[model samples]
Target: DVKVTQSSRYLVKRTGEKVFLECVQDMDHENMFWYRQDPGLGLRLIYFSYDVKMKEKGDIPEGYSVSREKKERFSLILESASTNQTSMYLCASSFPMGLALDSSTDTQYFGPGTRLTVL
Candidate 1:
């Protein structure tokens, strides 16, 4: 089973603070993603990486950055946290796209999520 782990489950920080959220997948999946979910706004992708040392900016990458120094670990960084940045941050991992071997298909496994409150 693929297991994704987040460094923190709940976080509280003041505005302008630098925040780091860590994620790790035990299955050595090639793809990892980060998203911030808010009420009614839905899940907004922040960043993702398809391979080690490579990353792609997601829809809402304005105040966020990502790092993938190893195959199993990906990190999300908030350059300058703000009140508007408060949301439930999710980390996920999955097999490389286009590699659906069977009916189970390529499914993304998500972590419990980190609820960040920026005040």
Candidate 2:
């Protein structure tokens, strides 16, 4: 079974602080993604990594960055956190896209999420 875990379930930060969100997957998936979920905007991809040390910016990546130095671990960094960046951050993992023989293999397993509050 695939399992994903986030470093925190809830966090509080002040404006302009550097924040690091960590995620880990036990399934050895080849792809990992970071998303921020807002009330009406839904899940917006912040960053995704297809392999170790390889990252691609997603829809909203201006204030965020990612690292995937190890296969099982991925980290999301908020360089200078701001109040506007407060949201529920999610971490997900899945097998490499298009390589799944069945639809189930392509499913992304998500963590419980870290709700960050920037004040």
Candidate 3:
């Protein structure tokens, strides 16, 4: 079974602080993603990595960055936290798209999420 875990379930941060959100997957998936969920905006992808050390900016990546130095771990970095960046941050992992014959293999397994509040 695929399992994803976040470093924190809830977090409080002050404005302009550097925030690091850590995620680890036990499934050895090749793709990992970070997203922010908000009330009306839904899940907005912040970043994604296809392989170790390879990252791509997603829909909303202005204030966010990602690092995937190891296959099982991915990290999301908020360079300078702000109130507008507060949201439920989700970490997900999945097999590389089209790598498996079954489409289900491409489905992402998500973590419990870290709700970050920036004051």
| lDDT (0 to 1) per candidate | 0.91, 0.95, 0.95
Clashes of each: 0, 0, 0
lDDT of 2 by residue, 1-45 (tens): 679999999999999999999999998889999999999999999
- What value does the lDDT take at residue 114 in candidate 3? 99
Ranking by lDDT: 3, 2, 1
Worst 10 residues of 1 by lDDT: 97-106
What is the overall TM-score of model 1 with all chains considered together? Answer: 0.93
**5-95: candidate 1 lDDT, tens digit per residue:** 9999999999999999999999778989999999998888889999999999999999999999999999999989999999999999988
RMSD of each: 1.3, 1.2, 1.0
Give me the candidate number with maximum TM-score: 3
1 or 2, greater by TM-score: 2
Off by over 4 Å in 3: 101-103
- Global Cα lDDT for candidate 2: 0.95
lDDT tens readout by residue for model 3, 7-72: 999999999999999999998899999999999988999999999999999999999989999999
